[model samples]
Target chain A: MKPVSVLKVLSIGLLAAGLVGCGKQETSKGELIVKIGSVAPLTGPQAHLGKDNENGARLAIDEANARGVTIGGKKATFVLIGEDDQADPKTATIVAQKLADQQVKGVIGHLNSGTSIPASKIYADAGIVQISPSATAVAYTAQGFRSALRVMTNDRQQGKVLGEFAVKHLGAKRVAIIDDRTAYGQGLADEVEKAVKAAGGGVVAREYTSDRSTDFTAILTSIKGKTPDVVFYGGMDPQAAPMAKQMQGLGLKARFLSGDGAQTQEFLKLAGPAAEGVSASMPGMPLDLMPGGKSFRERFNAKYGVIQNYAPYAYDAVNAMILAMEKAGSPEPAMYLPELVKLRFTGVTGEIGFDERGDVLGGAITLYHVRNGRWEVLDTVQGESAGKSK
Target chain B: MDIFVQQLINGLVLGSIYALVALGYTMVYGILELINFAHGEVTMVGAMVCLAVVGWLLGLGMAVPWPVILMLGLGAAVVACMVLGFSIERIAYRPLRRAPRLAALITAIGVSIVLQNVAMLVWGKQYVSFPALVPVVRYEIAGATITALQVVIVLLSGALMAGLWLLVKRTGLGRAMRATAQSPELAGLMGVNPNRVISITFVIGALLAAIAGVMVSAYYGLAHYYMGFLLGLKAFTAAVLGGIGNIAGAMLGGLLLGVIESIGAGYIGDLSFGFLGSHYQDVFAFFVLILVLVFRPAGLLGERVAERA
Candidate 1:
């Protein structure tokens, strides 16, 4: 009887405590806490790059709060809601739906081009601003969505630079290409192949593998017989790293070429010295050369160890939105949407402005090659068409 | 001709891994008449455990030698996989043994999903690079380059297969296993503990899968939570192609499939006149499977199986 009485008393006390807890949780130091979403493959093969992108956004949010950002005459706190899309287009749409449900003021990611393209329509339907920091596929922006913004140049520019560099710089007379058959990989490969043909280089063979493929023996065997001096892979670091190793295994002397997906410390380590002399291209200026890069790198290193190639663009994408928010004097995405489309500001990645299609104006592409087991910048190319490669 | 030789070399190395995994599937199916779909997930657990063990050693600032590290890692993976395999049988499959076959099959799939999710939670869902413990030294034979790692993989798998054959043919436990596999009730009457035989079979299969996991991941220098999915399917295909319940058939089927896939992919584009390419290599494997089934429905080596009650 006594124990039952005590249980009743405890239940009453707990109910009162729960009500009080709920009452006290709503008020905050942040008068206008705006929610922003960042989506990436935060838990998959591309997780390293995805986490780096999220960390960059998280940093910008923290620094913006630390800087005492104010919106609508009230102190504002920015909240970053991170979602893992698993780098699959299906998963990306699901994440986009989740962020839309949260009614986030803006969205900062959906990293891979395959992911970004599918998610753009969802963001557009929700009228939420979406800016990708690392999607390099040309079709991502070509869809003509206002909410779709990217800080990096598209694959068209990247492929042009890659093709020209392989031919003029590496002196590649014949080139062989392989891709993972994904939207991003195939799109980039197609652009490179088109560039190669336009430049009067012999396109020996065009082959593909799935993104999950681990063995490249068969494909490499075929490519080897073509006797190409250069082999280009349109895929991420995970496959690229292994392919580079396997290429060396089969005694293929062709230089490995790829887009930004392979240009990372992960690739270098995974390839394990087989990465030497392999050239890759990435959009935006090199990290060390960026205006705010040194401090950003130091701060990022303090929290998250290494920058896995897309953080600067992520930081810029975030800062770009913040800049628009500042101009509009509001954190509401609808109000700031126009301001973002007409944005003109210098970001960590350099000039940040969007054309009508939401492409970064005057976007630049840079080429890098692994030297002595470290990536060194080769040259930067801008405003170059594929036909006029050199 | 050089291309053909190169593709052949590539096929054999790739086939060795498939055979190792396929042996596990075929052996378990032989003993239990159960597909054990979670068998692939066992390989993932093995690789993850090995990586964790090696990572712990390296992180501890221990000056352990590479061979010792490899040995310890292999040991940990084998032990972990055995425990996992035993528990999966006891908890998931054993309950449904007396139940319908479809129930057991569904449970195997459930167990697979459960193991995948569990591994994803334990080891963060990323490709944790299995550090290169094996030295990558190259040797060219007959215009085909073979790395030291490739040599070890091919030779070690061959040795393992030989050992497995001898064990099945020579050991007393193997006699009990065959008796139990033939008729569980009759074997029980004859004083053979079916449960013990089944458990031993599982352990042996797990050991093979664990070793294969370590070797395959080490060769590629990368291991991810989902890496087992494709390899498992390919291995299962090898098992089926070689006659699912036959031991020697799995090894031959695995090697054959690998060569066929490699050669098919290499020559696919030119052979198909630009209508298809190397990316369709997986499709090509299934196509061959269809052709095989259309001709020899009993598979390449499968004996005539009696209808089950």
Candidate 2:
């Protein structure tokens, strides 16, 4: 009886050890998880724009995983971890530090320039590659951060395009500039001022407004007194729409023009009939011109029940990052930095390639005019070839 | 001269909305001595509720004209806001009646955060366009072009303020509110349900705020999740400028601040100094607040005895 009981105890010990060994094997199999972090304002005034960017990243990661992209000769998967920065620079910096602590391979977001500027510095210091789909501040790439790349064109290019269009197309002798006093807005305003002056067009007046301000009658009145032929706005859609309406109300007949930030349907809704003839320049292939744009529009509408404004650039941003990782043959951001610069791929936006400054080289800005309450593409000009156009 | 007149008219129209929202802040503070941070979110919720109702009506194959749609949307918003005000008073504020002032303020902030997140989750954090219920008609008055909607907002706000004044001066509920504000314990002992009076005060404040929200959404044609933050802060500033507990003072203060901000942005366009821009308007308003606080701490119409005490 004693011998039989001793054998029973040995059998029980063997079973426990075998079960522990199986658990260890499962843990080892899950150890190679590579996480890509996206930081944006998921819960603030700018949450809509942030969510759009996050969805782009999520779609890109999902497509990459489904294709079974191999890294280091082993099957690898991409995991997206999103952090809400609330569009605040301080919050963005903290979120950046948290992402860096987690050793994320790359980051795809932070939509606003105010948040992106500080967050970029943190990511650079941490040697993590960061790409922003919507940030257009000129100083974003000027910070000498090798890892910081913007999928969208800078405000400088956008401003130049608008200034040229005003001078050549509209035949404007004098232009007025107004900015909403954000980093992107002021930067774009300065760029437009410089371009306008260089094109021998005089700036009649330059004005500014705050992001939270609703009443722009005073600024419109000041601009009306100048009697400029054109008014260039460097701001997002929210302030730009009201400014357009108020300008029209104050009898300012100047042709209002703005950059990519003002290209959303909200602008038309806010400005109403006053938005007619207003022009805006945006980066990437225009929605109406993309090859699969019709299907993308239909699918996006079906999935989210809303039309997207910057969907293609967002899609391209994620695709570019994924391709860069595949070309580098490693999931580590530092290992893929040089490979990212060398990678050339066809994307939804156009042929995607990086310049020495990490800007999308040879990318074109599409001109759009709000006609009959819808955005109509007017022209497209490549940045590098813009000077040769004249 | 024409441009100046137009700008002044525009400023007044915008200021009227600010004043309406400011009245809500002033009244709630006057009685409870607590700043309802969630008041701004309440306004946002009102706007969202209006949007949802309009969308629902449109979906239901209702071919009613826009004016009727506007009325229905606004009515739904008011009901929802009143119910929300009542629940907030019952759950968040009522239990803290005898708690420290700081505790109530913190709880209000928490409530604001919860409302903002809940809105994001439910609405998916997108900017939804508010239906244009009012006809887009511009009437030229003395060279100043004002939208019919703008005129409606100003008149409606004025009517609401006058009605509030009459209610407080003549109604039994007003007397009860005044009695509770004077001394909650004494009012409670005098057969007045202080809790009920407080709840009524919150409901009235929320109604005013909801009206302001609907008007602004209609005027702007865009309703966003965080639309209330800046407006809320500005309304609070207006309330304080008018002697926070004084009703008439808030209205006057709001209009005055709006006009000042307009003029500042117009005549002060110095690019080198960055003086006359919209960004500096907030700075200008706060500067005015500081000056007023230094010179007239009790506000323009504040009771000296109450403020000093």
Candidate 3:
């Protein structure tokens, strides 16, 4: 072999390797990928609800990208990357870590309070802003993270309203409380207990149940023994519906009540005829009542042939995110964070504005009753009114 | 006493569904000794297929009666699950049959993951209300209220179990299955196609699981992509409790476990320590499994077989 031929071959090999490396680098550095991460229960029991929140965030990202938003004076498009936490806190933490590794600038999840409470710390430490469309735990945004905000109101306000409804509206002297023992369930239960006690109403009995359990005969029997006028359950619909049915089966005729977690068609299906007269307190007005929600509801019904729970809040969350981006004139988290904090925008649910604590300010909590297997709006009360009731 | 009877009936109804699914698990394990972790996902697929069929029938303006719908749904589920079972055996299990058990188990896990994600992609991660093929009307017998659907689930499971028992005991294929189970090499020498028997076992198991899935989706009125996970775990627990390789034992174990959980939830309330509520029902089942495994490793009716090695 000639020396010149060997040199030429070696140079060609080096050039090939360099080109491959450059190709990899180019693929990795495709124009500052500003990832908007979302965490939700994509695989477990609550996957349906979590997907709703994820879809809302995706809609916002899609709209932003379509319009070519600028961040840091450079045209940038938002990219959404989603992870399924399965509504588990540990899984949520892992998802948060993955997002951090990918260097996502912002996150628009997680749905469940139990998962969000721990996952938020990961985002906070990583300097990624997290805005949850659902998680209703009072402590969710209270950790003092400048970047944490929740589009939904806390259980504290919901609890107070429930207590007030029991006393002032239902004229109940005594109420029984039951919780499903999850963070969301127990937190709302505790708040309701406190508010009911403060309202000079007697809490005749308090009990707990598990989220996966279908039978509630024993708990209902115990509550029947107490003979309370009303029963407030702080749990999601899966357990709440069956609990309502079992309560009826056990001959406990106490009026059933619950929080936003129980506000769904699943509850009615589970409870069946037993669900009649049961009331639940939910954040924001019903879809038909909200001005923008009417069209959204029609479109959703047309597309899916069913009215979904939490669609209004989901729509509002996306609108709020988009409005904040428009106001900030950029997609950069650091640039838009302050603008998001100060922006007041009208959304499908209502006028969306966040307080310093990142809670929805001036939010109206509505009470609904299951009538003929449908959720019907009963009354709407503001946060201040709810607080006063407490 | 009446309340006890009612609770027992409820338990029996729920147990039959669990047992029906558990049979699939136990039979697959009896032949292949692999858990077939994707069995529950197969059930989910079956239920979803039924849902899609019903939706399509309704869309086509065909008022196909409830019984016809149910029959068609079950048939569709069976066919779909059989195809899935065959493919899983071929792609994931066959190549690794000679490999370590851990490899096969890992492959099963991968299959389960792939099926779950595929289900999510196809179903769109939402809970769709499954149509009620049977009237959900309730009937009171001796002061206990029971739904028509519950009765159907219980009767259908019993009939299927009987049919399965006869199939395994009376048919030549059944003899081959038994021979293979006893000794695969000996069965191969005796002109019994061991591989064919194994495939047949999977097909039967998949059929049972599909029936169970249809029954459950009808009972629950709602089905989701991940509905299989918890139900599969529960069915596995039922299988283990009854002796993993025992056919009839699985059915007995399922019924007993359901009754016990219901009774525990009913009497214990929030005061029965760990059995305070319904969510702790799984805990109760797990506790029973641990107790059973510690006391009777061969299960209640399970017979000890010679190790393959």
Candidate 4:
């Protein structure tokens, strides 16, 4: 019995030694490690776009790693730990707290405006830098959180551009507006309605639906009765695609317009031929036109097989954070955050800088028309650029 | 006037789907005195099964008639839902039959979550486009243009409901089902197989839900894992509106609810001076339910004692 007990003790000691040996792999001889947290709807309805945003951050970190970043006289390795928020505000706040607890040097994401707004408070309280890739709501940056910033242009700019395009370019005198009633959707729609009225277009009708609703037949019928020349929907692609198809089915002859949420390949695939003549907007320069966008797209297509919508913005977000950290000569959030607010760098999405409100400076909205079953850039309107041609 | 007719057509088309799903709720409540919250997930599974069968058959490039392929899809959906309904009863509900009502209700909720997650895994948690099997065209009816599918939905719903009414009133199986509902032990003593009768009743309800699910997918041209959640909720409201355990009441309740929602949405801005909009359509359904509960506690067609049930 004594001999058996000794054998068991030896085996246990050896197993524990082996397990300890397996955990830590040495890639750095005195190399400093910094983690950047990313949040998106990784497991739900918008996962395709969420994965695209995540891929952007991952690709940026890998490229940044290859360049061999050094801060505070120490070689640094950047890591991204992504959390799935389901594009939900509650989940966003919960994960925001978790990432703050993990002490990630900086953060990137909470992709929907609804989520980004709520989660920003948590990061601000924790003194962590948060850069949103694609939350375009006007109210997001308006909250005045020193730590909260976004790479993409907000809905105020997108809606103004879209409304102008519909009235002046499409030559529409009457417009109908519909929203999904989410914080993002309603905010965008209100802006569009305001812009439309300012652009000398008559508001014919207004309708709303829930995010979970599939049936829009009744609302479409009512909207059709108003006979507007253009109908704009402020919602995500899943609902937008079906609504587009239903509009055609209901014999509504008005042209369809939406913002970045409906401007996706999934919309083309889901809406089929109904997507042919629709118009939408994204909050950046066209990918091909941006200086770094071409190389980024090439590498991204090679790595992830597609660029949904926010990849370029996400890439810029990661680059912007790293630029701030490099400028500060530190990887700590508290040390780097002040520099992040004013850091100016040319990234894949364009020249990256922020104003007092943490909104991207010189923000632009790129208008797109679906031609030949693909998004064709119609115009690029930078706030300072005065209608640059796409 | 044309818009009003158009909305009415939309309401009826919507109502037909609601009526079919409501029957499932009403039937189970009639026979088992259980709510079966998992009933919605059963509908979701039915729709997904139909989509999967159709997609697989289309992918294989089989040169079959459209009608034939559609029939195969419906058949697949019905069978899958029946199997799911049976297992849910056997695995989740039967053991809890002798337990407290709260336990069974809690188990039903758990089963609902399990089905939703399992479906999310299988279907990939995104809105999948349900292909247009029918020709995409509309026919004008009284200044209201409606697709051929809408007419089919309305006609089919009426036929299904009528057939169900006849089956319950005039069939031997229906007699056994009613006997079991009245008193399971007494029915067993009277030589009726109570378990078998109950199982058949559950499957019958599932069959109705399955057909409704397929029609909804075709009508909307989209299907997702969570699609059944709201549809199930609306159907439950309809079930309660018609007296929880009544069959024809479910049909009437569904139609009335649909019309109310449609008209309420159409005229809400005018009614409220633009303070409220069509988005509040869901609110009207619950408001009616609350009003009915306040004024007529037994529901429109519900009896005081549930003696027939």
Docking class of 1: medium
> Could you tell me which residue pairs clash in candidate 4?
none
Stretches > 4 Å off in candidate 1: A1-135, A145-151, A287-358, A384-390
lDDT of 1: 0.84
lDDT per prediction? 0.84, 0.79, 0.76, 0.85
Model 2 chain A worst lDDT run, 10 consecutive residues: A23-32
- TM-score of each predicted structure versus truth: 0.79, 0.73, 0.68, 0.81
lDDT by residue (tens digit), candidate 4, B1-309: 999998898888888888899999888888788998999888888899999999888888979888788889999999999998888888998888889888988998999899999999999878887766777778887878888888999999999999999888899888888788778999999999988887888888889899998998888777889888888888888888888888988998888888878888887876788899888888888888898778776668887774533
Q: Which regions of candidate 4 fall more than 4 Å away from where they truly are?
A: A1-133, A146-148, A295-348, A351-356, A371-373, A386-390, B95-103, B178-191, B306-309
Clashes of each: 0, 1, 2, 0
Per-residue lDDT tens digits of candidate 4, residues A1-390?
345434543563454345335422224376677778888887656888888999999999999999999887778888777777777799789888877766677888978888999999999999899999988888888998888999889888888888888899889999999999997788889999999999999889988988877778778888888899999999899989889888988889899999888988888878877788999988887777887877888999998997887888888899989988888989888888889886777777777788778888768788888999899988888764312311
- Scored against the native two-chain complex, candidate 3 gets a DockQ of 0.11
lDDT of 1 by residue, A130-161 (tens): 99998888889898888898988888878877
* Sliding window of 10 residues with minimal summed lDDT for model 4 chain A: A19-28
Best by lDDT: 4
Ranking by TM-score: 4, 1, 2, 3
Give the top-scoring candidate (DockQ): 1
Best by TM-score: 4
Instruction: Point out the higher-scoring one by DockQ: 1 or 2.
Output: 1
lDDT of 1 by residue, B251-275 (tens): 9888988888988988989988988
Which candidate would rank higher by lDDT, 2 or 3? 2
